[model samples]
Target: MTQPSGDPAATGVPTCYRHPDRETWIRCQRCDRPICPDCMRDAAVGFHCPQCVQEANRSSRQNRAVYGGERSADPRLTSYVLIAINALVWLGVLATGWKNSDLIARLALVPKGTCESLSSDGYYPTALGERLCTLGTQGDGHWVPGVADGAVWQLITSQFLHVEVWHIAGNMLALWMLGPQLENVLGRTRFLALYLLSGLAGSVAVLWLSGAGQLTLGASGAIYGLFGAYAVIAHKVRADLRSIATLVAVNLFITFAVPNISWQGHLGGIAGGALVAAVLAYAPRARRTQVQALGLGGFLLVLVALVALRVAALS
Candidate 1:
């Protein structure tokens, strides 16, 4: 006997590197390692072993969006969730009694506390309620807390509130139309941050500009913010400007022309969105994420300071 050759190939049987028990003639194109059917992964040219495929994946770069955000697998999912929340809240408000609903009393953004009558028109002064008129004395009503009264939760909650069917309908329509497109470009996380901050900016504007007892509620402010953000992004990517400009102009007309509309909130939201979009779109690729985060943080601090200043002034 010639000592039966040392190589397994001498017996016309070569085992897979990963599975020694299985015999295979196929070899990985990259590593030239024998790969059994179980370990084989299809490649551009020939099959590759599991190890080689994983190595190739590890070395490959991840795909990113224009603003340096990771590409979202489903861009519309976030928008859908937001819509669901607003819808659920609207349904709850309807069930409770629309405008008379205690839910609205607690959620709507009231700049200053108001003594409202449940069975009558016109709000009474808090002092009058304590002296000449009480909750059940002159009328049936309760004292609704305002932002200045430490009802800070209203800043965000008011965004989801709506008493009119047309109001919620129009706002939800605009959101559905604009949200996914923006989310696709900026990714879910960035898009959501832009939305929430823009909405808060509107609330802050209400705190500063509207009458102390004025009631402001609806998603129009945030919707306007999206319009402004879309315009910035459109300009950044060099998309057509005519449509967005026309849309914005039309909305502005509606904001001012329509009675009871919060022009302050709309204008503030647009300005905030434009500033934020500029920060996100123009950040340098070098240290891009860090720069964006710092810029957003600075903007948030400015808003908080504005809120604090308003609170101090109220006090």
Candidate 2:
């Protein structure tokens, strides 16, 4: 009796072990192992071995779980929301029909003495008043009374304000790309804390470096804070460092190349965020909870000290 031509035992045809009746012509792209139609899976326009396919599926599922299985948790979404908010605020200013709008100055943080007159009468001036005071004039190196009178609050608020749409858009884009992943790893609370502290550090740097002249606004400081956090976290998790370095270099280039960019704020935020992250990452793992509490407490104390010093300076 003559054997079949395509039979494995006859002409060396590779038979599908599972489906003995079939001959396999394709190989798994990943494992490079032979597989029949039933065993092969389509993976990005190519076939995959059963074991490789299973492993890839498992990885994908794990990633999905980490991302909360929702598309909105995408880092880009956070960035978009921030940009939208800033744009809306700008539009609101335009809609209010105010001429010579001082919207940015009013909401932005300034140095001491730059707006001292506005701080008179025991009441910090209105946002509009602050804007009016800083108009047609620049500030100097130290925190000005009226300019950054309530700078403690400005630390957080300043992250949302911007002098230009492009400025806000750029910062938001960076934030959107970097924030979610950091948030995912650090969890929302820690991430938020890092952002706030980083912004504060940036504001403080501005106060120390510029003194009172230039009016600073925008989220770059806080976004840079995220960059700082990213570096620390990447190291802790053994993630690729090259990517983080690339991001830092690109942003630094932008800061230097672009006119009117706040290099102080960027540096301050990066430093602060990295400091905090280092404390968080390097502290003994067994005492992580205690260490985190202590770190947070220290931050709060520093914040309070800054506020008290500003008030004392005014008096």
Candidate 3:
């Protein structure tokens, strides 16, 4: 910046353009305009005049990502927030205890909750507003005493309700590892939508493939979705998928080999995530947003179809 000459009386003191009364020897680092201390704002390189600062800010914002997030903002912020929410939810569920609690029964998405059931063996206290079942009570189950009134919200809520610390920890670890890259590439809104939809799809899978009397809950479905998303993103960038495929294969093997794990949910979540990623990664830029919305909506409709079919099969 050009410094004000010391001969103030000869040429008058160089003053702030915005505050002419105040004399100053400083100039804006950006615009080189002489500014008083009050009008000056600290900047990366040096001080800036208020006008220059405003202009720079406007320009910076204009260069932000399509979703209005700064490119330089922490890419992991969305993932961190998701982890925090899941942790808090786990804490709440733990506080309530895993067994015989209305809180958990309300959250776990069970297919039987969506329809009339013959028995309530797998359900919580239905009298407490939980319309319960899941994979168990569809046709042959007994009306258990404690099942709650059934709710459709469980399909989504169940994804966030992990009763075990290891379960949530595993899921969060996977998220922390994979979420930031996708968030940075897809932006926050899209990443969140992908996550939620994938998880819901997983639940829907369980509803369709598992016995209506079976019970399931956790974030595994959503995390599986991220795995699929990471693969698709790699493909989009022309990166090799051998490693991602291997990781997915191992998880799939674990899903099938493990007892008490929701394999149906995991598989369904992966399929859902890959489908969504296909839409996001390959859509034409000219109408990308519209295509993405339609693709996701179509996926959701497919899930609804799956749920409806399950209900009919049991009905």
Candidate 4:
């Protein structure tokens, strides 16, 4: 059958499908439908209709970061969230009697459980056995469980716990500075993984190196891990290293020279961060994401193994 023909004057040579009342000779490059200027969207080859353009955009692969993670739209958002969490926890500690807070007893990383005097906020000597301390309840002291005694949450909680104003302030400042940078590079998920794992590494160090009764708490380990990750990323991209090297040196000096600083945590964090960053930076492009995931899993297993060994020894 012959196709019906319309008058050219009534509907210019080829009318836009979206605006049949109007006239347009231009056709959509994608769908081959007549389109007016209002409906046309620029494309590599020619114009596309709004619907076709939307469909194409919907089907296109999402942008990815250098190391295969999805690109983050708001890098600073994650950093702000982390800072808020740390600040809020510090406030809780502040409200609960600062250094004497029972919250600290529950959250702070202690390799082995200890007996604490609730009245004086002091720990009883280990020579006084846990059995003896268990009997002396009200006035004497109470048993405070540690990682060995199944307070496993302490490994993570201790990183967020801070008793001193200056301590929290310093760590928050460091986080605000470093967090966004890493997030932008690694994207939110990988960056968060690097951070939490680094903190765990620091806590593990404290568990093994520091005295059993030594109360270790703070984000310094995580902060140190950020520093280590930054250095690794910078080196990978061939950025100047002198500045970061100097900063790390200065921080190391402070870690060792300071009276009450936990050097073990800081060093352990650095090692963990560097290791994670290395995996992120060096993973082969063909299977970048898979390699990164496997490397990180291996690292986590190592940390878990170390913890198991330490717990066995302490037990």
Candidate 5:
């Protein structure tokens, strides 16, 4: 009998279906329901009611990009910032620490902790006058003394520190080349985690496998992590991974071929990076955050256990 109020039969002006108290001629472009200004939301082409917006989103297939992030986001921003920090660190090294052994000793990763015997030797100090290098020791030994000597923080700090001009340049160049693509695919936050965690895992490998008193520092471990990330992500999407694989192979060859490079660090980093990429690329979308947290936490615990076990064995 009533052609519905919205048909303009009952009243001259259409009434809002949601807010019956408010009268308006506006109708949702999708559902054709009368909506008030309070219920209006901007849509791409025209206004939509809240219900229509939600329903549209629900019905949407949520077409995911191969890399797992929203297609709309830009991953380059974080990569650029990360590259800048690394470059700044290198600049600081050049300004005050290019030849400063003390600064290098203070920051570089040293496996040995402070002890009466000085444990082992064959390590060279980046700084000559530092107490860590000059301190009296038993047998053939070199000691690097610092307030933070043998501290756990060295694992993190050591990644950003480099010994020579070509060293930082080489590492930073690789970072610049590989960083943006992976960052875009993984998103900024996950990419940062992969880089740091991969580097840490590399350091942990050094701690586990390197001889005592070896001083190892570089961003190579982290860069290697990125390499692993790209490879793993590609594999997940069923995309070609051979290009990254070849790069990894060449780098690994160089790692072992070079005298000072740490193959232990490289191998550790690759393994860590691959595992982390698995966590990021393969996680279920519904529980991605929770799954990532659990995976990372588990790996961290493994590192702590390895460190404690190694320390206890030596002590």
Candidate 6:
């Protein structure tokens, strides 16, 4: 039998067993094994043994499986696309000479005024509640009363109506940046549910807090909700907490510094997203799916109830 080539007891210099003449100064970072230059691969963090390189690749693939397979797959969340669509619609409205059209009046959540208009035109009331005061002059600069009537559908539709180009652009930018990662992690359905619910919660908060003085319209509520969800999930998974905290702080600063921004919507959306995330994250694994579904359903129902009450109150 051939004798081993290198001195086995040398310090600092690891002699290759196969080639005793060659000494290795670097240790493989992955396995901490002594390896010659011929058997080393440069990795992002450090050098790895050939065997460890293969194992690292294998582990990366396994983790990808839990993230819904292929790294290049499309995101489940559609918030970015939705933002684009809303922008396109705004442009189309401008192009069609409808820039000043009452599109928002028709689609936005102006509970009191909408209910009154519908009721006067023969719509039946659906719920019993106090009539909310309406703010701002309506079409042709005419003062309209009870614009704050609490219509639930407004909660969903309000997210699509922005008061200005800058408003929509800001919200869309945030959505585009944060939405893909969330959609990937939560899957499409859950991501969408969170967005819609957050928007509704924000609208509700505005109605409650402004109580008919402010005419609120924007997607910031939903966007803030996405941030809230990310923060909660990051904590639960022990992800990089610093990143989430930075995002929250930057957005909060903007909300406060900017004039005419809807702080109520931001707060409401954040609270709603965090609450839903907590419910989903803490439920028993077996019951988690059911709990998420039921929770979403209940939230939607409450939104509908609010809308009905607003309609009835105005009537």
Per-candidate alpha-carbon RMSD to the true structure? 4.0, 9.9, 7.4, 3.9, 6.1, 9.9
* Per-model TM against the reference: 0.82, 0.62, 0.69, 0.83, 0.75, 0.63
CA RMSD (A), model 2: 9.9
Model 4: pairs clashing at backbone N, Cα or C within 3 Å? none
- Model 5, 150: alpha-carbon shift in Å? 4.2
How does residue 112 of candidate 1 score in lDDT? 75
What is candidate 4's lDDT per residue for 1-315, written digit by digit as tens? 966556554534787788876678899997899999999899998899999988987876466677777779998888899889888988887788777777888888988888777566442223244786788854576788889889989999999988888899999998999899899889889999999999999999999999887778998888999999999999999999999899899999999999889999999999999999999989998889899999999999999999999999999
Each prediction's whole-model lDDT (CA): 0.83, 0.66, 0.76, 0.87, 0.75, 0.67
Q: For residues 1-315, write the lDDT of model 6, one tens digit per residue.
A: 977635644444676534566787777887787778887789888788888888878876543312232332578337657877778766755564343445555455554553222332221221222233133122112323344433445667668876567777888888888888777776676777778888888887776665453456778888899899889888888999898899899989988898877898999899888876666556565666777678778877886677556545546
Off by over 4 Å in 3: 1-72, 113-150
Number of the top candidate by TM-score? Answer: 4
CA lDDT for candidate 2: 0.66
What is the total number of backbone clashes in candidate 3? 24
TM-score of 1: 0.82
What TM-score would candidate 6 get against the native? 0.63
**In candidate 5, what are the lDDT values of residues 1-315, reduced to their tens digit?**
745555543576777888777779888999999899999999887789999989888877463334454432666666667767777766776677365545565677777743222233322453333354446544323545422343777888888887677887888888888877887676666778889999998998998788666678888888898888888888888888888889989999899888989998888888899999998788888887789779978988897788777766654
Candidate 4: RMSD to truth: 3.9
User: Relative to the unseen true structure, what is the C-alpha lDDT of residue 303 in candidate 6, on a scale of 0 to 100?
Assistant: 62
| Best candidate (score: lDDT) | 4
lDDT, ranked from best to worst: 4, 1, 3, 5, 6, 2
Instruction: Kindly list the per-residue Cα lDDT of model 3 for residues 1-315, writing each as its tens digit.
Output: 977656553467687788766678999988889988888799887898888778877877454544333353677998999898888888887677555444665677666643323244333434221233434445433333211233667788888878767888889999999889888878787888889999988988888788655668888999999999999889878898999999999999999898889999999999888888888888877777788888888988988887767667765
The number of clashing residue pairs in each candidate reads 0, 17, 24, 0, 5, 9
Q: Write model 1 residue lDDT over 1-315, tens digit each, in one string.
A: 567765676677988898777789999999999999999999889899899888888875455667977667888888888888889999998898766777876888877776666665332233232233344564665677788888988888988888788988988888899999988888888888888888899999999999887788887778888999999999998999999999999989999899988998899888888888999999998998999999999999999999989988876
